[model samples]
Target: MATYEEVKDIPNHPEKYLVDVRNASELKETGVLPSSINIPLPDLERALNMPDDLFTKAYGRDKPAIDAVLIFSCKAGGRAARAANLASTLGFVNAKAYKGSWTEWEEKQSQNI
Candidate 1:
C-alpha cells in the first residue's frame, strides 16, 4: 500500500503512475489527487491491455511498462486494492494500493488546513 506522503509526492517522480480508480462522476463529485489519472475500475482491464500508441492516444500518457511503479486509489480503498491485484495478475510488477484512498486524503487535507 502507498502511504499518504507517497501519494502526495507523485509530482516529484514523473515515472510513477498514480491512478485513481474512481469513475468520472465520482471524480467530479470529489476532486482527484494531484497527479492521478482516471481509468475507472470497470475500464481498467481494457485500458491496460491496449497497445502502447492506442493507450497513449486514449489516456494522453504513455502506457506504463511492465515494471512501472503504479499506485492505485479509489473511494475508500477496496477498489484500489482490487485494482492492484488485477494489475499484478496482468504482469505488472510494482502495483500498490493506497489503503486510505480519497477518504483519507480528504480527511488529511482538511487536517492540514
Candidate 2:
C-alpha cells in the first residue's frame, strides 16, 4: 500500500496501470490524475485494454514490469484499497492502494483546471 501523495512522484510502468474506481458522476464532479485511466471497480471483472502507446510513453519501460504497481485510487481510498487487494488476490502481484484518493487530490493546492 502507498499513500496517494507518495505515488505522485514515482513513474509508472511502460504499460502504466492506473485504476480510478469513482463513478461517472464523481469523475465529472472531480478530476483525475493527468494520465490516469478510469476503470470503475464494478467493471474491473471485464478485460482491460488501455492504449499501449499512451501508457508506455508516460511510464518508461525501464524498471517496473508492465503488470506491476497497478495503482488503485477512488473517492477517498476505501474502495480503491479494496480493489487493489482484490486485484492482488486475482494475481496482480503489484496492486497498490492510493490512500489519499480524489478527496485529497482536491485538497491539494496543485489541483485545478
Candidate 3:
C-alpha cells in the first residue's frame, strides 16, 4: 500500500494509474484528484477489461498497462484495499491501495491551504 506522501505525488505522474473507487455520489460531494479515474468499486473488474477505445471513451483516459502502477483510493481505506486486492488477484502486478485514502487526502489538502 502507498502512504499519503507517496499518493500526493501521483497526480504529477501521468504514467501511473490513480483510481478512485468511490461511488458517483461521493465523487460529486467530495470532488476527486485531478487526474484520477473514477471507476466505482463494483465496476472495476469490468472496466479494466473493457476495450481500449471503449474504456477511454467512458473514463476519459486510456486503460492502464497490466504492469502499470495502479493506486486505488476510497472514502476511507477499506474499499480501496479491497479493490487493490481484486486487481492484484486479476493479474495487475502493481496494484495497491492508498493507505490513507480520501480521508487523508482531504486532511492534507486542507493543511496545505
Name the candidate that leads on TM-score: 1
Model 2 regions lying over 4 Å from their true place: 10-15, 48-66, 110-113
Candidates ranked, most accurate by TM-score first: 1, 3, 2
- After superposing candidate 3 on the true structure, give the runs of residues whose Cα lies further than 4 Å from its correct spot: none
Judge candidate 2 against the unseen true structure and give its global Cα lDDT, from 0 to 1: 0.68
lDDT tens string, model 1, 16-84?
Answer: 999999999999999989989999999999999999999999888999999999999999999999999
What C-alpha RMSD separates each model from the true structure? 0.6, 5.2, 1.0
lDDT of 2 by residue, 29-105 (tens): 87776566676788664423335564445434323343677788898899999888778777778888889887776
TM-score: model 3 vs. ground truth: 0.95
Worst lDDT window (10 residues) for model 3? 3-12
The digit string of per-residue lDDT tens for model 3 on 1-113 reads 98887788887889998899999999999989767889999999999889999999999988888999999999999999999999998899999999788899999999999
Candidate 3 Cα deviation (angstroms), residue 50: 1.1
lDDT of each: 0.96, 0.68, 0.91
**After superposition, which runs of candidate 1 have C-alpha atoms over 4 Å from their true positions?**
none
User: 58 in model 2: Cα distance from truth in Å?
Assistant: 18
